[model samples]
Structures are given as C-alpha cells and as structure tokens.
Target: MSRRDSLPPLNPTRAFEATGRLLSVSKAADELCVTPAAVSRQVRALETFLGVSLFERIRGGLELTPAGARYLSDLMPLFSALRESTEGVMAGAPGRSNVLRIRSPATFAVRWLIPRLASFHRLHQDIDVQLTTGSAPLDFRREDIDAGIQLGDGDWPETHSQRLIPNELIPVAAPSRARRKGWKLERETLLHSLARPEDWTLWLKFAGFSTANTNRGMRYETSLLAYQAAVEGHGVAIAQKALVLKELEEGSLVAPFDMTLDRGGHTYYFAWPSHRPESKSLKAFRQWLAKVVR
Candidate 1:
C-alpha cells in the first residue's frame, strides 16, 4: 500500500473537471455521454472523497469555488500529458490508430473539403480522416492534431503553410433569384456573415459602393451559412467564388454578376507544424491536397 494508491476514480475526476470547466452539469454530461444527474452525482462523489467543496451552486449556474478553480488549473495539464503519453504508447501498438486529426474551419470543411474527402479515402484506404472545425487559435503542441486548413495570408508562425485556393468575393444567389432580380446588385436584399464583416464591405468597395452607406440584411455565423441562404433564395450573398465553384457549376446556385473582389490577403492554406515528425500518410494527403488545389 502507498499514498499514491488512494486516488479517486478517473470518471468522477473527469466529471468534476468538465463540470467545473464548463460551469454546467448538463454540458459536462453531454460531453461525457452521461446524464446531468449522473454528472452531479459524480461531482458530489469527488467532493466527498476529497472533503472539499469544488463548486457553488448559483441561481442559474454553477461557479467554481476558489479552491476548485485552482484545482482545475492544476489538473488540466496533468490530464493532457496523460493523454499524450497514452496516445504515444497506443501509436506503437499494432492496429491501434490510422487516424489523421485535421483541424479546419466550418465554412471550408462543409463547402469545399468534405466533398473531396472521398477521393482521399479512395487513395488511402488505411488512413481514417477525422475533421474537427473551429476558428479558435490552434496550438499544435497542446492539441492532438495532424494538420489544418486555414483561410488567410499564408503566414503562420512556426508552421509550414502553402496557399491552396485563391480567394475572390463575388455576389451570388439561386439561379431563379438571380434571373428575377437581374442587374440590381444594390437593390437586392444582402446576406452577410457575422464572422467576416469585412467580406461584404470589401466587395461593396470593389463594386464602387460607399461601404459607409451600405444596406443591412440578415446575418449568419459563417460564409457557408450565408452562401446557403443565397442558394435557398433568401438573398444575395457575397461569397468566395472558389469555394462555391461546385455549386455554380452544379446549377444549385448562380452568380448574379461577373464582378469579383480578389484581395491578396484572403486565401486558403494547407498547414502543419514545422516541427511535427512527418508520416507517410500525412505526406500523401498533403500531396493529394496540392494536386486538388492545382
């Protein structure tokens, strides 16, 4: 018997950590695939086992007690290291993992990358592709990621980045909508993305409109959503033409005009950590992506 042997169960610890971090039992439960009551019970078990109040129940939510916040800070890095070590060990085991974790933005994943995934799968039958989408800053060292596709000027610090798609904003809508509202770019109801307010403004300026006097319209969280709104005849959406090329060619949507705004700064890039040890699968995938983009 040793002092280190009397630790609480990992499940309860995970429940407590997730609940403390998210500040919601339901959200923690959702993350852990347990019920809210189960999460609450686990947290209570952890608190009782440790003899400390980890959280204070507030009027509408849970707030981490001072001790709990400090505890969470201490625990996250430990668990992260554990995960990394476990993964490294697992990677050495036979038939353990052939998955490549790809971080991507939602708009690109949905509108562009997903459609071409089949080709990648056909070429590399042993490699499994796992896509995770978000706009938050990525840390390759901290996160379990193989590669990423980012939209911006190809200038990421400490990362190998290459331009994949040239970005150009152009007005688009459903074919019927474009046909009915011919040659009325200024008058058409405008759709916009809340994420990139600059896309609309830049297109407006390029088309000789005073962005200061621009008309307002419905807003979505991403360009893909705005593009979908246009496809469904909601309104004219300023979109990256390269992303919507399939839709344009497939007859699901049509451009209202030939005008485009090609800014040098707005483009898509394929990126990976400059220091990550390259694998054969990663090399093959990157080569395939380069071929696709070209």
Candidate 2:
C-alpha cells in the first residue's frame, strides 16, 4: 500500500487544514480553544506524516506553500459540506431545539427589540433568541438566521415580510433641552437621524411651518444615537414614534409639538426566507410579536 493509504485518520488533516486556512497556529488554536503550542505540534505532526513543508515563514505571518494551497483548496469543500450536513441534521431534528438567530439593524435591535425581549422570553420559554446587529442585509442561506427585522418598504424580493409597525416620524427633544431653551419650538436646534433625511422637512410641512431649515444640523446614523444626542441637550431629533415611545413616556424625551408625518415608505418589517417556513418556536415568537406590537 502507498504511504498516503497508510496515513492516520482525518483529525490531523483537519487540524492542518484549519491552521493553513487561518495562516496562524494561534488563530487556529483560538478557534479550537487550545494552546498555540498544541496547534503547532499538530501541524508539525501532519507535516512529518505527509513528508512536505506546508508553510513558509514571512515577516509577520505565515504564508502557504504551493502544496499547502492545493491541499487547502481540496479540503475546503469537504469541510463546508460536512458543516452543512451537520447543521442540516441539527436543524431538522425535533428534540434538540437550538437558538433562533435573528439579524437586525443595530439601532432597532437596541432601542426596540432588546427592551421587549423579556416579554418574548416570558411567552415562549423554550425558544432562545440570538440577536446579531448589523447594517447589512442577511442572506438566509449564507447565514444561519431564522428571522430578521428590517426597515424598508414591504417589498423584499424572494422573502416573506410582514409589516410590524406603521411609519410615523415626529420631532422630539430632551426634556432638559426643552426646559433650558424654553418652549420655543421655532428656535430649537435640530438633530437629524440619517435614516430619514427628509423627515424634518416632512414634519415641518405637516406642522404648517414650511419656512424652517430642515437640511442644516448635526446628523446621526441611527435613532439610538439621535436619542442620546438629544438627551445630552445637543439638539432636537426627528424620531420614529415606535422607537421613542418608551423614552417619551419616561420623560427622557419630549415631543413639544403635536405635528407628525405619515411617510409611505420605511416601516418596520419581520422577514424570513419565503421558501423556508417558520419552525414551531419561530412561529410562536412571531405570533407573540404580532400580539405585542398590535
């Protein structure tokens, strides 16, 4: 038999592959949660068995040799397949209920979901929700996300989306800021939320104050930041009603004017892949969400 046929089982091969792909024994060790020396020893053993030098030392990091490159390319697909199969089996199993991964915008997750999560837990005690915040949209197949909360028009292609909240923007400021500046709505410095650039203009128009300068002010990327900025007496912010309701109720934020705008686009939406129906846990959570939001 050839030496390759007489080689040991695939554990050492996997270790080598992980180390080669990461290009650092330390990183591989971190992923495996073992010491760097252990990873180094495993890689050395694999090199001795294969009779090939797999990596070259560089200035700061290790670079793969030609042999190593070829080896990694061949094994990558195998690892990916193994991972997919394992995840598929785990996801399909009825007894083992893993976490339901959810992706959402950071501001929305922090301001909206995090506060209400306790109620969800109370309702569905068995379903564990794992939330990851990002600005980028998620690919359901590429990411193992069970559901997502998105802010946009209800027209996401190839996905099932349910409208969670209506779109309403209003001008709000910190109570301290309002108190310090006196209730002079016309002289209030505006803090802008980046998601809705035209919110101030629309709100101004709705309030019949068409002459106010809506474009000039400090801008923040998220409502959470805008809320914080307003609370710090920086400026007044145009905020979504759903996001600021708790703050308003608690006297942290105050809406001095009754003027509000009902923009047609940009509503909160609950979404998931259309092809994949919700699991029982996800369904229960979704139903609970509908009840709470309604």
Candidate 3:
C-alpha cells in the first residue's frame, strides 16, 4: 500500500488538529458540532496511529505533550493558509449568494436581533441572516461570516465599522422579585453578568451610594442568564437598558432607579471586511439598521 493510503482518514486528522489548536476536546466538539466523546475518541485514534501521546491530563484539563506542542507549531501556519485559500475560493464562486452570516454576542442575538428579525425579513426578503453567537472577536477575512455586530471600543483596525447604538446601563429586576422581597434598589442582592463585573459598582456610584459590598452578587456570563435569574426573582442585575427595553415595556422587569450610566467606554458596532463585495442586500440591511437606531 502507498504511504497516503496507509494514513488515517482526513476527519480524524481534522479532529486532532482542532483539539490540538483549542487544547480542549469539549471546545473542539463545540466548534465541530460533534460530541466530546467523539472528539476524544478521534484524538485517541490519531495518537494510536501516530504512536505518540498528544495530550496529558493536568488539573482536570488537557495539556499538549511536547510532541503535540511541536506538531501544533508546525500545523498552525498551514491551517491559516488553508483558511485563507478557502475564503478566496468561496468569495470568487459564482451563483452562491443566498446566505449572510453574522456574528454577535449571545445575549444581543437573543434579545435584540431575534425580536426585530421579522422586520428585517419583511423589508429584505431576499437575504437570509444566519447568526453565530459568541463573545470572541471574529476574523472577517478568515471566517465565512459576512458581517458582525461587535461590542467593544470602536477600534477595529481593518474593517468597515459603523456604530450601531450607544447604550446606557441600569439596575433592573423582575417586578415579582421587587414585590416579594420588598426590595428597594438600595437593599437588593446584586446579580452580576460576568461580562461587566464593575457594572453594579459604577451604577451605585452614579446613584450616590458608596457601600463597600456593591460588587457582591451572583455572577453570570451572559445577559440572557442574568435576565433569567432576575426574572426568577434571584437578584437585581445591571443590564443595557436598550436590550431590556421590550421586557421593561411589558412589565416583566422594572428599573428601580432612574439613573443611567454612560457606557461610552464601549458600544455596539456593525463591521464587515473592507475587501468583500458589498451586495445590494447587505446595503439594504445596513440602511435599515441605521434607521432603526436613529
């Protein structure tokens, strides 16, 4: 048999590559849309085929073996090159313009985009917007995503970035929570979204309250989780007022204080690669977003 025919399948190689790149089988599984067991098995099979240990267990997590470290150092550049070549081919392909992918934070995707998506659809029936939600910054050139709504200081170095909205954050809780606990704004157990640990402290400072434990709270990673906790009467959360506006209008949550903090330190921005073709659909979507925010 030839050397190429003796090698393991490409899928196993890909699994090993992703696992090595991320250094976590669970993360590799998430990225590949496969189960953790599957990723683990694939990695083990690859290790057996190569006759070397690729990873070692450390503190209940996986770490690369020295061999794996050297392998990854060699593989990363090739992987990047492959990604660039694939993107170039996809961009040049003809008759493949039915999808638009967008990356945004999970909370923003759930609370803001999902609610107003119907309107976007009504206006532009041709474009289908597929959302990928994560907290990580996207590489527009490497990924297949057409555009992204990013939350950060507007300093994307090499993309077309437009400010989507300026946000003000305030303390909020479910009406039930407020009613049942008889909790006024000053006496509530603060629940924090991990994205903004100092949110409660800043809001408290804005409200002229200088308590020492202003930062004490149940912390969550996403605003969606924070909102869920607040709705279940767990604790009060400091959230972007705009994100919770619909819930506030519907009385699901109430702002205990009228004070708002200027989070101009960061803002939401819509960004796309500067080199990509700007289609009519993309232009329409941008214009609609501009009008909605205005």
Q: Give the top-scoring candidate (TM-score).
A: 1
* True-vs-predicted CA distance for residue 236, candidate 2, Å: 0.2
> What's the candidate order when arranged by decreasing TM-score?
1, 3, 2
lDDT of 2 by residue, 1-294 (tens): 754355444367767777876688887776556667777887888889999988898999899899988888777656645654565577667865446778988878987888889998886666678898876665554344678988888688778877887778888888877777456766778888786577788788888887787767789987778889987888899888888888899998898877678776678888887756556766777887888788
Give the poorly placed runs of model 2, Cα more than 4 Å off.
1-96, 180-183
Candidate with the larger lDDT of 1 and 3 = 1
Error of 1 at 126 (Å): 2.4
**Alpha-carbon deviation at 25 in model 1, angstroms:** 8.1
Q: Which candidate is the best by lDDT?
A: 1
lDDT of residue 26 for candidate 1: 90
Error of 2 at 133 (Å): 0.6
Q: What would the per-residue lDDT of candidate 3 be over residues 1-294, giving only the tens digit for each residue?
A: 855455444477677778877668898877777778888888888889989998997897888899987887676556655654564565556643345678899988898877888999887665678888888886753354678898888687668877876779888888877776565666677888787677778878888887647756788998789988988888898888888888899998998777899888487888877765675556777888888888
Runs in model 3 lying further than 4 Å from the true structure: 1-97, 179-182
> Tens digits of per-residue lDDT for model 1 on 189-239?
889887778888888878787744444788899998999999999988888
Q: How close is candidate 3 to the true structure, as a TM-score?
A: 0.69
Looking at model 3, the pairs that clash are none
Sliding window of 10 residues with minimal summed lDDT for model 3: 2-11
* Model 1 weakest 10-residue run by lDDT: 1-10
Q: How many residue pairs clash in each candidate?
A: 0, 0, 0
